[model samples]
Each structure stands twice: as structure tokens, then as C-alpha cells.
Target: MRISTITNWAYGVTVGLTLLSGGAFILSARSADHERQAVVESQALDELSERLTMAAEQTSEDARLFVMRGEDRHLQAFRGDENGERDREQALKSFKAAALLQQEMALIQEIEQDGEALDAIEERAVTAYTNGDQEGARQTLFGAEHERVQSDLLTSVRQLTDLIATRTNDALTDAKQWSDFWGAVAKSLLGLTAAVFLGVLYFVLRRRVAMPLMRMTGIVNRLARQDYAVEVLTDNRRDEIGEMNDAIQIFRDNGLERERLDAERRADQRTKDLILQMMHRLQACQRQEELAEVVSLFAPQIFPDFAGHLYVMNDSRTALSSIGSWREPRRAGPVLTSAECWALRRGRPHVSDAAAGDIPCQHLEHADEMGICVPLSAQGDTVGLLYFEGASDSQAIASARLYFELIAENIGLGVANLQLRDRLMGLAIRDGLTGLLNRRSLDDALNRIARDEQGDVIAMMVDIDHFKRFNDEFGHDAGDEVMRRVSAILSETVGEAGTVYRFGGEEFAILLEGGAEGSALDLAEKLRTLIAATPVTYHGRLLGAVTISLGAASTTADMPSADVLLRADAALLSAKAKGRNRAVADWVERSSTDRRRA
Candidate 1:
């Protein structure tokens, strides 16, 4: 029940009991009042009876005195007694008005008749004594008839007094019984009221209100400290305590919700911080491989459930090759053609799952596996592809799409930067006219070759025969065309066996690794013959028959790279002195013996 209802019930019961007790007290008071009135009336009746007996005795004595003495004082005393008899008569009349019983009234009437007879006898005696009949008066005053009448009168008064005492004592007993009964009832009611009040105080205040309030105080304190794990007790009563419990339950639920949101917020902030750190590292990456390593290191930390690969477009822009991968991703191949990826073709991210109806990327090894392909592009050019797989659930992959795109964007820019830097470096070390490694690249290559003390290194120097004459005969542009054709021949002959450099102005150099000195001289002679065989076509004009002089040097155990180049140039000068279109070697005797055997 509601607290208010309980309190009202307690109050009502207390009031009712109090009223009952009060009514009982009122009844007891009335009983005591009746008992007091009965006692007063009984006393009055006894006093009146005693006075009547005295009056009768006084009248008899006064009459005898007058008869004996005949003095006027005795006569006056007799008259005074006669006058006092009226008071006795009035007392008897008062008794008649008191609702007396029939037996008691008859007794009182008999007494009244006897007193009148006695008084008449005294009056006659008094008259005779005054009229000179002393003997007669004396006899009448002390006569047997007067004595008998007086005796009857006194006897009747005594009987009336005993009757009044008996009646009054019975009335007092009845009044006392009523007063005691009502007093017991009042006491019982008062005791019941007190017991009921104590019960209400204990049950309602102590058990219902105080105990529950104490328990709720502890719960509220824990909630204030943000301890949401604490359990809330439920109450089903429709009372104030129940209402407070419900409010606390609501507060606990809100605290749990706030805790969950706070955890998510902190996780999201940490992810953002990781992304920011990754971007900063990406900016400092000097090579595509370094950038790949950075991504590989941080990707798992960012999304541990996902396995991914970083792919960069090849120089031909036709295929993407994996530069870095993490978590041993499935279905991402080492190489994929540009046309095989939808992300690359469409320039956006493509996601595929087991339930998705869309076509999957051709680059994926498994057709049914879930995956996402995010194209990495920078400044309107697609630079690479980022492929991811192995998300535990679709929602996880969906939530991770944004981070994937962010990683792809940064990787693309980094790869693009690395590619641009490589292209610029290439231009810096390449010959503009001949499309071969320039002098600076040759020096660097020769230095590297000199450091390798275990390998046999060969250096060949070649020059066109009469190159300045051709430039003076035809135009310089035709001369330029001839030199370009000869450089192409030298490069094609060397292939992967060595590097060819344009030393300067129709002078070229070739550096080979792991070739004998005789083999080097033979290779130089073959290059001199091919330059004479092939003619140059410049703007549809054929410049005929460009021959070249060649000189070659091979490294011994301790030959420096610079000394080898100088010896090869000296041999070229010796070939020019002997004849313009022949080959010479620093070990010329070994070359001749090997040539004779061929």
C-alpha cells in the first residue's frame, strides 16, 4: 500500500481507540456521580429520622414538667416543643416526595399518626394543669397510653432510618459496580490504543521506511562514485520507497550507457592518433620500400583483424606489384594487371563479401572470399592498389573502410613522390642526346667496379672514325644522327653484360664484369665492324658507312678503375695511329694470339 494510506490507517485506528477510551471514562465518571448522590441522600434521611425521635422525647418531657411545677417557664417550654413538632411534620412530608416504596411510605404514615396522638395527649394534659386539674394532667402526661404512643413513634422513626440506610447502601453498591465496570473498559481501550500505536511505529516507520532508506543510501553512494557495476534491487510496492528505488535504477542505467559511450570515444581517439602518427611517418619516407615498411608495421596496430597488401604500379603503368604486406593476407596476389582491378579502373573503392552480388576483383585468388580493394591515387593519377581481406564480420569491414581510404591516400602520395624522385634522378645521370648513362654515371659505376676486388672488370673505349669530317660534310644534325645510331648499336650489343656510357662528343665507354682480356678485345672489334655496317637515317637522308676505332682494358688483381679507363683510352689512340677502323688492347699480344686461334 502507499505510505500515505498506511499512515492514515494508523492515525484512524489511534483516533478510534482514543475516542472509545474517552467514552468509557465519561461513563465511569457518570457512575461515580450517581454513587456520590446516593451517599448524600442516605445521610440526609438518617439525620431527619434522628431529629424526629428527639422532637417526640422533647414534647413528652415538656408536658410532664408543666404538670409537676405549674411555673410559666415550664408552660413556655411545652409550647416551644409543640411549635417544633411542625418541623418534624415537614421532614416527613419531604420523605414522601422522595419516591419512596409503598412499605416505607406506610411506615412513615403510621409514625406521623402516632406523633399526632402523642402531641394531642400532651396538649390536653397541659390544659388541665392550667385549669386546676393537676392530678389529671400529671396522669395524662405520664400515662401508659402516652408512653405506648411515644414508643411507637420512636420505633417507627428508627425503622425508617434502617430502611433508608439499607436502600442507600444497595444504591452505593450498584453505582460502585457500574463505575468499576466502565473503568475497566476505559483502561482496556487505552491499553489497546497504546499497543496499536507502537505496532504502527515499528512496522511502518522502522521496517518499511527506515530500513529501505538505509539500503538505498549505500546504493546511491556507489552510483555517485560511477561504479555502474553495482546491482540495483527492485521493489514492486506502490510506495515512496519503491519510487526511490525506481529512480536509482534509472540512474544506474544512465551510468552504464555513459560508460559505454566514454569507452568508444577513447578508442576512436586512439585510432585517430595512430593514423596521425602513420601519416607523419609516411611524409618522411624516402623510398617506396621504406613507405611500405612503415605501412606494414603500423597497419596491424590500426586494424589487427584485417590482412592487407600495398601494391604499386609498375613503371609501364600496366600492372601493380606488391611492395609490402602484413598478416599474410589471403587472395591478394603478388602482381595484378591494371585492368583486373575494379578499384583501379573505376577510381574508387570496391567491397565484396560472400553475400554481395557484385562482381569481385579479378586480381583476387579466391572468388568467394570477402575483400575490399581501395585504389591509391594522387593528383589524378592512380599510383597503386591497396587490398584487404579477412575481416571477422561485415560490420567490421564496413567500419574500417574509412581508415583504409585514409591509408590508401597517404600511401599513394608517398609512392608517387618516390617515383617522381627516381625519374628526376634518372634524368640527372642520363645523356640527353644519346639516351645512355652519362659521364657522371660511368664514374660512379667504375668506382663501384673498383671496390669489387674479386671480379675481372673490362673497360672498352670506342670513337667514330673521322667523326668531325662527317659533321663538316653533311650537317651537324646528320652527324648527330650517326652518333646516336652507333651508341644504340653499342648498347644493344652490351645488353645486360655491361653498361655503356657516352664519355663526350662521339667518344663512348663500355664497362663489363667477369670478361677475359681476349674476349674484351674481340667484343670491341665486333662493335667497330657493326658501326661500319649500319648507316644513319636523319630526316629521310641516309648517311653512309660510319666506322669506329675501339680500345679495351681488362682488370688484373690490383688494377684501379681510373687506371683501367686511362689504359683503354691509350689503346684507342694507338689504334687511331695504326689504322682508323681497327681494335687495340692493352694486352695486345694476348689478343693477337687469341685472334689467330679463331
Candidate 2:
């Protein structure tokens, strides 16, 4: 049965048993009260009977004394015995006052008659003794009617006492029996109630609640693990467990759907991995040939039924050029792209039912032709386009579109990486401070000039005089400004024929190509004079004008090595020794003329 049904029954039975037990207890109590009342009545009757016997004995003793002495003293003494007389009168009153006084009416009447007969006998004996009829008084005393009445009264008292005692004992026994029976019934009821409670608890916990809960827990675990094969056990209950079972069944169904979802997740992950791998291979191409190889590798793998190509824009961005091209392996003929190439270059995909008219090329004019073109962007600039063609199918084209975007992104990154590498190389070769060819790039320029058709090259080394004092007095920041202005002047003055280099602290070097010795010396002196005329100011302070000492050397076919650079260094020292601001030139003996101070 359902647990509710069983619970209701158990509750009802328990209540009924409780009421029955209560009724039994009430009956037992009433029986005990009745028994107690009987005992009280019997005790009262016994008390009355004992008091009457004592009263009779008192009267008889008084009468015997009166008869033996024939003295009014004995009668007066009896009358004066107020304590005993009061007790006898109280006893008689008590006998009459009993609750069942009518039931002992015969005993009471017997006692009253005996009392009257004793009074008469005592009077007759007193009269006889006073008249000197001692024999007659003896006869009256011995044959007194009070004797028989008193004996009969005593017998009745004994019988009444016996009845009271017997009834009290019977009541006591009955009270004990009733108490024992009720006590046993109470114990039996308590034991049965305990057993019923325990049975209910065991049945509910082990079978109904606990066992079902355990099975439900197991079902939940299985559901969590995505194992949907486990069966759910549920009784046809209208309680909480029934609701839980239905919920679990719903959960199991949902879990099955979740399994399908998990499968779709794995499939999507595989598709993502495939697209990523293809894009990664596409991005690794540094040259058009590498890109062509990537296309060849992916075209047959990704689009086995269609031809594919990658069309890149030229450096001038005027037209599209084919870099990578592929045809299906089964098709033996050369695939011409004159038909779709124009449409592909227009930054859109094209589909041709039959490649005719606007679709160029007789070879590619087919009804089954479908093509896709996606723009490749690098740093927000369109670098190229990826072109692909395949049989017209929704799923195939959809998958290809996903791959197309990834491929475009990959090519974009490749182009960006190459451009950045070239730019950084240029920055490395140039000076950060003056935008001039730094000392490191001078060797490269020197080697290029040496190999060039320009037959002779002049090298000059220059230094700023007292540049450290200028920095200390005016602060290094203003000094740096001065240096920048000087470097800029040198760059503008030298123009294209010469390249300036910052060669260590306060020193500069220049290479002039195919220049005569006089021209080289004149250029050096002009640089020196111009720098000397230019004064630098810092915070309204006139730091004074500055000048540069320059040294010049020439390199012919004979002095092609970098050693010729030292001649310009030696001449610069000579100019510095002569004065602070000047220009000196190393004139080959043939070019020497006048060595005038500048």
C-alpha cells in the first residue's frame, strides 16, 4: 500500500488503542474507588461494634457491684462514671449513625433490648438485697433476662464485626486484582504501541524513504555522468517520491538530448581544428611559391571537386595577380581562369551557370561553375584576395566560406609580419636621435660607395669644440637641442652626395662621393663657419656661439679599404691643435696647394 494509507491506518489504530487504554484506566480507577468505599464502610461498622461491646461490659460491672454491696454508693459511683457512660452512649449513637444503619437494624434493636433488660435486673436485685431477701437477689442476679439479651447482643456484634472484616478483606483483594489487571493491560498497551511505532519507522525509512532516496541518488549520479541507460524505479505514489521520480525521468530525457549536444560539440571542435590547421599552413608562406604550394596542398584536401587559386594585389594596388593556382586532380586539361578572374578581382565571388558572354574563356564556360573570393587584410589594409571555386552545393560552399575567412586572416598576418620586419630593419640602421645614418650603417654605405662607379670618395670627421662645458653650463637637455640643430644643419648642407654619421661622443663623420679635394675642403670649411655663426641660448642665457673642427680624407681605387678613414681622423686632430674652431683637409700630394687657416 501507499505509505500515506499505511500511515493513516497506523495513526488511527494508535489513537483507538490510546482511547481504549484510557477507558480501561478509568474503569480500573472507578473499581478501586468502589473498593475503597466498601473498606471504609466495613471499618466504620467494626468501630461501632467494638464500642458497643465495651459499653455492655461497663454496665454489667456497675450492676454486679450494686448487687454485691446493696449500697446506693455503687449505684451512685456507676452514675458518676461519666467518662465510661459517655463512651457507651457515643457507641450507641455511632451504631445508629452508620450509612447502612438500617442493614444492621436487628443488631441495634438487640443491643437496645439488652440495655433495658440489664437495667431491670439491676433494679430487682437492689430491691431484694435492701429488704434482706439475699437469696431472692441472688436468684434475680443469676437468672437475669439481661444476661440472655446481653449474650445475644454480643453474638450479633461478633457477627456484624465478622461481616465487616470479611467485606473489607474481599474489597482489598478485589482492589489489588483490579490494580494488577489494569497494570498488565497498561504494560501490554505500551509494548504494542512501541512495536507499532518501531515497525512504522523501519518500514518508512528502510523501504519507503531511505531505499527510494538511495536509488534516486544513484540515478542522479548516472545522469551526471551522462549515462542514460539506468532505469528509474518508482511506485505509483502520489507523494514526494513520485514527484522526484518523474523529475528524474525528465532529467534522463534531457541528459539524452545533452548527449547529442555533446556529439555536436565534438564535431564542431574537429571542424575548428581543421580550419585552424589549414589557416596556419597558409599563414606560414613567405613567398608566392610557398603560398602556391599551400594552395595545392589544401585545394584537393578541402575542395576535391573544384579548382582553387590565390589572387594577390601588386605593390601598386592597381590590379590583381595570380600567385597560387590549382586544378582538380581528376581533370587532366589545363584550367584557364580568364572567365572568373575579372569577377574575382572585383572583390566578390561569382557563380556561373555557364561561362559565356561576360564570363571569359571558352575552357571555363561550364554550367556547373561556382566561385568564391574573399579579401585578405593586414593591419586594416587589403593585401590580397583568396579565390576558390567548387561544385554548387550549400554545405560545401558554407564550409568553404568558414575556411575562406580564416585563410584571409592568415594571409593578412603573413603580409603584416613581412612589412614590420622590413620597417624594424630600417629603424635599426638609422639613428634614433637625428634621423641620420648611424655609425653602424656607415660601414655598409662605405662598402657600397667603394664598389660603385664613383671613382673617388672623400671622408670627413668633425667634432664640436668644448661640447662638455656647454652641457655642464646650460644643462644636458639644452646641449642635446644644440646637437640636434647641428646635425640637422649638416644633413641639409650635405644633401644627397654625402651621408652623415654620429661616430661616438661629440664626433661626426661624412662620406662625399666623387668629390675633388678642393670641393671636399670647401664643404668642410663651410660647415665649420656656419656652425660658428650659430649661437645657442638656454632659458634666455646666451651660451655663446659654437664651432666644429672638421678633417677630410679622400679614397681612390687605390685607398679602397676602411683604413683610409684614419687619415680624416689625423687631419681633425691637427685642426683641433691649431685652434678650437677650424677645418683641415688631408690633401694628397698632387691635390695640395695652399694650407690657409679657416
Candidate 3:
């Protein structure tokens, strides 16, 4: 039964028992009142019997005194006793009204008859004594009839007293017995009520309520401490305790679910932290090689089950090549064409899990293999490819596919940044018009050579003879063509023996390391002759026979490395001063100047 129902039943029973006990007590009190009334009435009847006996004895003694002493006082006392007979009569009347037993009433009537006869005898004796019949009065008072009547009256009074005493004693005994019986009944009923109350308290309160509550208290304490792993047993009872158990089961279930959610949240946070760390590392990378290394190192940490290669697009954009691989990937090889990878072809992510009925990428060695490819893109241009294979489960790959694509996107951006930086560096160091090293690069080379200070340095400065006349005659396009043709021949004739640079416009400089001055002059003359013999063309027409002035200088221990290019320029100006289209060496110019001074 339900606890409420049980308690209600207990309450009802206790109330009923309490009421019955109360009623029993009231009945016991009523029975006690009856016993008390019986005792009181029996005492009243006994008192009346004693009064009659006393009156009988007093009148008879007074009559005997009047006859014996012949005294008027005795006569007067006997008359008073005779007048007291009315009191005796009233006492007899009390017996008849008391509702005594019929047998006892008959005894009272017999006693009354004997008392009246005795009273008649006493009155006649008193009258005789008054009429001076002292002898007759004495005879009357002491005669056998008087003696018998007196004895009989006294006996009847004694009998009445004994009867009253017996009846009163019987009433007292009966009253005592009745009082004791009802008192015991009331006490028994009260004891039963108390026993029932105690039984309910023990059985219902202690066993049903207190014990179950105590057990649930322990469970609640554990749950409060967030111990969701603790086992909660099922309760099938149909009581309030059963309801509490079901509630506790629900609470435990909720706690377990919360714990699961918390664990998942913590794991997701950890994964995001790793992703953030990888992104930071990727951002810090300066080269495709370094970015490949970073990706290889962190990809396994991020997706341990996957093994793949980082493939970057080649410089020609023709093919993709793996820069790094992790976890011993076997399905995806070292090189893949753009058309071979669906991810690169479609410029998106593609899964190649054959077990899942997905089409395999053409780059995979086995058609039944599982893999995922993400095309690395930046600024709307797909630049590289990420191929992952060897994942144990397709579901694992599917779940982390987003992170793969995210990592690929960031890596693509990083690769794009590296390529852009390389292109910018190349532009900054190369001449835009002639495709030769610019002045800045020449300075950089000179500074490097000066710092190393190894071997003799030859500096050649060359210029096209009257190069602006071609622009005036054939337009600036023709001048540009002359410069281009001459620059190309210069570069081809010098080959790897020297470094060529276009300082500006038609002016060019070359640096050769560790060459003789004679060799430098010879190479300068060869360059001057080769350019003069070579005809130049602009559009479909031959412009002229283009020749060039040349200046050559070499580094000496006494000369600062920075003065070599100036010395070559000075020689070229000398060659120009003498005549155009001639070659001059700074040493030869110096020698001529020395001779002129000498």
C-alpha cells in the first residue's frame, strides 16, 4: 500500500482505539457510580435498621425502669420513648421505600409486627404503673409474656440488624467486585490502544518510512557530490518510497548525461586548442618546406588515425608533388596530377572510401582503398592538395573532415603567401626592362665580394654606341630592341665567367671574380668586336651595325672594392672621349695619363 494510505489507516485505527478507550473509561466510570450508589443505598438501609434497633432497646429499658423503681421520671422517660415510636414507624417506612429485595422486605414486615406488639405491652405497663398497680405493672413488665415479647422484639431487631448487615456486606462486596472489573476493562482497553499505536510506529514509521528515507539520503549525498558512476538500484514498490526511488533514478540518469556532455565538451575544446596551435605554427612558417613539416607534425596529433601527404602544386602548375608524408602512407603516392585528384579537379574536398561505396581517386594505388583529399586554395586559386589515407574507420574521417578542410585552407593561404613573397623578392632584385640584375643587386654583389675579399675582381662597364639615335630614328621601340639585342649578346658572350647587370637605360656593368687585367681587356675587346659585327633588327627591318664602347677595371689591394665600378666607368668615359665604339682599360688610361705627365 501507499505510505499515505498506510499512515491514514494507522491514524484511523489509533483514533478509533482512542475513542473506544475513552468510551470504555466512561463506562467504567458509570459502573463505578453504580457501585458507589449501591454502597450508599446499602449504608442508608443499614443506618435505618440501626436506628430502629436503638429505639426498641431504649423504650423497653425505660418501661422496665418505671415498673421496677415506681419513679415518675422513669414513667415520663417511658412516655417519651413511647412518643419516639413515631420515629421508629418512620424508619420502617424508609425500608418499604428503599426498594430492597422482597425477602428482605418481608423480614422488615415481621420485625415491624413484633416491634408493635412489644410497644403495646410497654404502654400498658406504663398505664398500670400510673394507676398505682405497681405489682401488676411489674408483673406486666417482667412477666413471661412481656419477657417473651421483649425477647422476641429484641430478637427481631437483632435479626433486622443482622439482615441489614448481611445485605450491606453483600452490596459492598458486589460493589467492590463491579468497580474492580470495569476498572480492569478500562485499563485493558487503554493498554491495547497504546500497544496498537506503538505497533504502528514500529512497523510503518520505522520500517517503511525511516529506513527507506535513510537509504535514499545516502544516495542523494553521493549524487550531490557529482558521483554519477554510482549504481542506483531499481525499486518496484508501490509506495512513496518507490516514487522517491524513481525520482532518484531520474536524477542519476540526468547526472550521467550531464557528465557525458561535459566530457564531450572538454574533448571538443581540446581539439580546438590543438587546431589553434597548429594554425599558429602554420602562420609562422616561412617556406613551403617548413609549412609541409608543420602540417606533417601536427596532422597526426590532430587526426591520429589518418596518414597522408602534403602535396603542393609545382612551379609550372602542371603536377602536384608530395613535400611531406606521415604515418607511412601507401595508397596515395609521392606525385599526383591535378586531373588525377577529384579534390583538385573539382576544387573541393572528396572522400574515397570504397567501403562506403565512394569512388576512389585516380591517384590511389588501390581502387578499394579509403582516403580523403582536400584541395588547398587561396584567393580563389587552388594551389595545393592534401591527400589522407590509412584511416581505420570511414566515420572517423567523415567526422573530422571539416578540420581537414580548415587546415587545408589555412595551409593553402600559407603556401600562397610564401609564393608571393618569393615573387616579390625576385622582382625587387631583378631589372624589369633587361631581365638582368639591377643596380641594387649589383651593389649587393659588390658588398658581398668586398666582405669576402677573396681573389681579384674584374668590373666591366659596357654601353651601346649612340644608343639614343636608334630611338630617334626607329622610335624608342627600336632603341629598346637594340638594347635588348646587345644585352642578350653580352650575356651570351660573357657566359658564366662574369655577372651582368643593367645599371639604367643603356648602361650595363659586369663583375668577374679572379681574372687577369689582360684577360679582362681581351674579353672587353671581344665584346666590342662581337657587338660591332652583329647586325640588329627592329620589326622587319635591319636598323644598323650596332657597336659598343667598353670599360674594364680590376680590383687591386690598394683600391677599395667600391672604386672598381667607378674606375670602369672612368675608362668608358675615356674610351668615349677618344672615340665611340672602342674598348679601354682603367690601367691603360692610367698609363697614358702618366706618360702625358712625364
lDDT of each: 0.86, 0.71, 0.84
Is 1 or 3 the stronger prediction by TM-score? 1
State the displacement of the C-alpha of residue 424, model 1, in Å, after optimal TM-score superposition: 3.2
Off by over 4 Å in 2: 1-37, 69-77, 80-89, 101-103, 123-134, 205-207, 214-231, 234-238, 264-598
TM-score for candidate 3: 0.54
In model 1, the runs with Cα more than 4 Å from the true position are 1-200, 236-243, 315-319, 331-342, 355-370, 390-399, 429-439, 447-558, 568-598
User: Could you give candidate 1's per-residue lDDT for residues 1-598 as a string of tens digits?
Assistant: 9888999998999999999999999999999898888888788877777777676677687788778877888788878756664667867877887878887898899988998898889889888888899999988878899889988988988888888878988998999999999999999999999999888889999889999999988999999999988899879988988888999999999999899889878877888888899999999988888999999998888888888899999979999899999999978888999999888889999986656777888878777888899999999999999888887487778778888998888888888988898778778898888889999998988887777664788888988988887788788988888878888999999888888999999999999888877677778878888778886777787777789998888777555565889989988898899988998887774468779999
**Clash totals in order:** 0, 1, 0
What's model 3's overall lDDT?
A: 0.84
TM-score of each: 0.64, 0.40, 0.54
lDDT of 3 at 537: 84
Candidate achieving higher lDDT, 1 or 3? 1
Leading candidate by lDDT = 1
RMSD of 1: 8.2
User: Candidate 3 on 421-504: residue-level lDDT in tens?
Assistant: 877876998877677888999999999988998879999888888888898999998888888888888889889888889988
Report the Cα lDDT for candidate 1: 0.86
Clashes of 2: 1
- lDDT for 141 in candidate 1 is 78
**Residue 522: error of model 3 in Å?**
25
lDDT by residue (tens digit), candidate 2, 1-598: 6677788988988887777777777777776787787678677767777887777677667656777776787777666654345455677677677644354666667667766666667667766777888777777766746577667767876775676577677777888688778867866777787777788788866777888999899889988887898887656877767878899998887888888789767766765676567678756666556756776676565555667656665656655566666774221123334333544346444444344334532324343455555666777676665666666676766756666676567766665565566457658887767677788898787777656646678889999998998889888877887788789889988998688998877788998877788888888888988888887777788878888998888876666546557888888898899886888877743245443321
